[model samples]
Target: MNTTILDMVKIEVTKLLAVGIIYPISDSHWVSLVQVVPKKYGMTVMRNQHDELVPMRIQNSWQATRKDHFPLPFVDQILEKLARKSHYYFLDGFFGYMKIYIAPEDQHKTTFICPFGTFAYTHMPFDLCNTPSTFQRCMTSIFLDLL
Candidate 1:
């Protein structure tokens, strides 16, 4: 609402755009509204190379998007599989979700509007309802040989 907050939002958006994480989208049928919160407390969010919080889009498209119901292995199942393994590999996906690319035709579904401008995600954002399954599928493919 105030000029001070508006400036901060603009700065964040500019940074994301420069990094190719988001692109200016003038028209999107699925445009979602943007709200500037002090932090990304609950949802999956990220920080740029400078460690500043990047602008994140919050869309309700998850309510309609088809879920990729890839069941995650239960802990006991995982333990059973690894019980006698000679070695184990652990990967931290702290920022891995952001590395997953979003399809060009579907990027608009993640679009959001703000005082600065309208934009859409170029990579998978973790808040999506299907993100967990999508990420799991990706990890499964990458670790298929290991498994």
Candidate 2:
């Protein structure tokens, strides 16, 4: 594959928001140009600087198979325990805007390839193994006194 062409196509799609068109150039070769869209679902393929292929959103396929057995408190239980409270302070943006950093050495594990180029995430992404558990662990550590 002519990766240069693929890279250029990716850049146009991502940076320029251009629409992609596919055409069969030869009996054995087909060329496709695509536009990058905000991901609601599905997977994207990207390359790293090492010219490796990384597939994004592949976690969607395995998400259904993951089991949650972490020792997290149930919401109902917390509510029951706090029933005697006179006033309650509701905290907004508890987990909504939290940022988790990824270790530099492990950032490569989060690398993904796009038609334009390969990139790595500097922060923890939503779609990763044990993400919920990891987040829960962090939240627990932060709110240990409250919990």
Candidate 3:
């Protein structure tokens, strides 16, 4: 039996969910976050911070308008710290690709839509408003004793 495009998309998405790459979002609105893009292979879409599908025209607009005021460490400060250490051991967190568990109560806020269905993230998504700060906080909490 030949699987239709929707069926194929569903299969791929299901695999992603099974592996903890994504989670289901129960109370999701279609119009708010689901945009269907035309593709030959299968369904494709752009997920926004609210886990919504972003239309092409509005996607750029949204990105340009969003403001993140979270403060990052100054490069000079980091450089000074590094220079103080004679031997520096670098632990790569894969460019800050750390796994951050999402709170159960707030998981719904990360819901997004695909061609087949809606899903939420079990781990922190990079697009969240305060992801950098949140990640930094987590790191600080974990390494406080060591530091």
lDDT of each: 0.72, 0.47, 0.59
CA RMSD for every model? 6.8, 12.1, 7.6
Ranking by TM-score: 1, 3, 2
Top lDDT: which candidate number? 1
| Every model's TM-score | 0.66, 0.45, 0.56
Model 3: per-residue Cα lDDT over 32-76, one tens digit each? 353334457754544443543332223434642243455666779
Q: Model 1, 47-82: lDDT tens per residue?
A: 333333333333565445665779877889889988
Task: Please give the TM-score that candidate 2 achieves against the real structure.
Answer: 0.45
lDDT of 2 by residue, 1-147 (tens): 366555554553464223211111222111122333223464343233433222223344653224555776688987986897776665433232226666766555554444444445455544455556667777778878976
Considering only N, C-alpha and C atoms within 3 Å, which residue pairs clash in candidate 2?
10-116, 20-33, 45-113, 46-113, 46-114, 47-113, 47-118
Candidate 3 Cα misplacement greater than 4 A, ranges = 1-16, 29-71, 89-98, 145-147
Model 2 lDDT-worst window of ten:
21-30
Better of 1 and 3 by lDDT: 1
Cα lDDT of candidate 3 equals 0.59
